[model samples]
Target chain A: EAGVTQSPTHLIKTRGQQATLRCSPISGHTSVYWYQQALGLGLQFLLWYDEGEERNRGNFPPRFSGRQFPNYSSELNVNALELEDSALYLCASSLGASGGYNEQFFGPGTRLTVL
Target chain B: AQTVTQSQPEMSVQEAETVTLSCTYDTSENNYYLFWYKQPPSRQMILVIRQEAYKQQNATENRFSVNFQKAAKSFSLKISDSQLGDTAMYFCAFTTMEYGNKLVFGAGTILRVKS
Candidate 1:
């Protein structure tokens, strides 16, 4: 089976600009998630969407937001990008509400470079 | 809140040798899940193994296995017959039902397999 796939493998943006990363989940999956992996800060959960609705969000600011499409694809939008925003943004998908035994599958992350 | 920690930032081992990566997590929930993910230079997150908190037996996948200590709250990954393809960044993660299944990740350990 094909794993999750992400687009725009790399992105470059200036301060105060916005960046958008896209992801397509594996077949038969209905949940999408976003995570940010900073150089030294580790991976932080960004957002979670299930069945086309926002289910949960991380400690990140409101500027970091995203949505899941009807087909289970997702897009992460980071507004007012700062130098600190530069990092590897990873997208993952899972089968939701199946007794919570869902294990997530991730895609190739998008490297966002904010100047 | 939950926190995961990987004390070893980097580790190396000869090919075909055995290596272990340590991880510790703090959580108040009685039931949860632990996962190990490998991120290669390609920046794709691949699930290495998983251990459920309530499961007495550890989880194993092919050459990868986990040492889960519930009382001590420790979950470590052990790779047997390591290969060059095992070189990657390994992350320890946690999730609970109350947390809406959002992952709480550790800083990560970089594992390098030597020839």
Candidate 2:
């Protein structure tokens, strides 16, 4: 089965410009997650959507936002991007609720380079 | 706020050897989940192994096993008979069993397998 898929694979944006990254979850998965992996930072959770609702979010700024569509695909938007925003953006999908045993499958991340 | 930390920034393992990566997390919640995700040079985030907070028995998958110490909030992954394909970045992550499933990750450990 095809795993989670991310678009562009890589993205480039200038400082103060806005960036949009996309993700398509597995065939039957209902939960989608977003994470940021910077040089020094490991993987920071950004946003999560389940059944078309924003279930939770991390400590990131409001400028970082995303939405899950009816088809379980997701889009992460960063407004007024900063140089510090350059990092690998990862998208993950799970089959069930955020339960302990439900492991998440991740996509080949989108490398965002903010110039 | 929950936080994960990986003290080792880099690790080296000779082929057919064993190497362990350490991770620690801080959380007041009694029930949660822990995970070790491997990102290869291809940049795809893959789940290596997972451990449930309430499970006393350690988790093992193929040549990968986890030594989980709940009291110390310590979770370490050991890869036996390491191969060149193991070279990549290993990230330790955690999430509560709640609805959000927001995963918190550490700084990550870069494992280089020497031939």
Candidate 3:
């Protein structure tokens, strides 16, 4: 079975530009999660989608947003990106709705570099 | 607000040896979950192990085991007979028992296994 798949393994953008990262969850998974790994901040939760509904988000700004599709695919959008936005963006999927025991399977992540 | 803290920024262990990484988290909620994830050079975030807050028994997977101390709010991972393939960034995360599985991650520790 193919694990979660993310698009544009690497992305480079400039300040004020908009960047979109995509993710396709594992088959039969209904939950997709997005996270940001900044240089010193480690992995911070960005957004979460379950059954094509926006569930919860982290402390990120409003510009940091995403949506889940009918197929359980997800897209993370960062508008007006800044240099601080350069980080590794990860996508994870799980079988259940809540609880951490569901075993979230992660993608290879999208390395976003903002100049 | 929940927060996870990994005191070790980097760790080194000789091949075939054992190493432990420490992590602590702060949460007001009594019921929650904790996890340890590994991100290799390929940058795939993989779940190493997970411990439920209510479970007294520590969670283990293969050579990976967690020392979970609920009273101290501490969770540490021990990798036995480490291998070169174990070289990666290890992150500790926490999540509440909410509807959406939102994760709070720490500043990861980079583990290097020397042959």
Candidate 4:
């Protein structure tokens, strides 16, 4: 089966602009997760979407929001992007919330560069 | 809230040698999950190994293994017969049922395997 896939391997946006990154989960997966790996902040959880609902989110600001489609694909939108928002945004997927032990497979992250 | 810490910011190992990356986590939840992810220059996050907090046995995958200490709240990754391909950024992560699918990740350790 194909692993998680992300679009726009690289994205460039100016400060105060908006950016949209997309992710496609693996076949048969129902849970999608978004994470941000900033320069020195490490990998931080951004959002979790399962069964088309937002389950949980990290301490990130409301400007960092996303949604999951019925097909389990997800899109992360950043409004009023800032220089600190430049990072590698990664997407991961698992079986679902029921399978807590299921491993999450990740995508080749989308590198967002905000100037 | 849960937090994961990787103390070693950078490390190096010779080919065919063994190297261990240390991680410590703080969580009150009795049941949770720990993971080790590897990201090469390609920037694709790969699951290296996983350990369930309730499991007494450490998890091993090929040359990669984890030494999990529940009481001490320590989870370390040990790579045996290290290879050049193993050079990458290694991250330690934690998650609990209460947190849903949100993963708390460490600052990450950059491991360079040399020939």
Highest DockQ against the true fold, candidate: 4
lDDT string, candidate 3, A1-115, tens digits:
9999999999999999999999999999999999898887778888888999988888889999899888889999999999999999999999858445477899989999999
lDDT (C-alpha, whole model) for all candidates: 0.92, 0.90, 0.91, 0.92
**Where does model 3 sit among the CAPRI classes?**
medium
Off by over 4 Å in 2: A98-101
lDDT (Cα, tens digit) per residue for candidate 2, span B1-115: 7889999999998999999999999999999999998989999888899998889999999999999999999999999999999999999988886636777788889999999
List of clashing residue pairs for candidate 4: none
User: Over the true interface residues, superposed, what is the Cα RMSD of model 4?
Assistant: 1.0
User: Candidate 2 residues A31-64, lDDT tens each?
Assistant: 9999898886667789988889888888899999
lDDT of 1 at A43: 92
**Chain B TM-score for each model?**
0.99, 0.97, 0.97, 0.98
Q: Estimate each model's TM-score.
A: 0.97, 0.94, 0.95, 0.97
Candidate 1 per-residue lDDT over residues B1-115, each given as its tens digit: 6899899999999999999999999998999999999989988888888888999999999999999999999999999999999999999999998898789999999999999
The TM-score obtained by chain A of candidate 4 when compared with the true chain A: 0.97
TM-score of model 1's chain A: 0.96
Q: Write the per-residue lDDT of candidate 3 for residues B62-82, one digit (tens) a residue.
A: 999999999999999999999
lDDT of 1 by residue, A1-115 (tens): 9999998999999999999999999999998999998987889999999999999899899999888888889999999999999999999899974577598989988999998
The list of candidate 3 runs beyond 4 A from truth reads A98-101
How would you order the candidates by DockQ, starting with the best?
4, 1, 2, 3
In model 4, the Cα lDDT at residue B16 comes to: 100
| DockQ value of candidate 4 | 0.85
Q: In model 1, what is the error at residue B68, expressed in angstroms?
A: 0.8
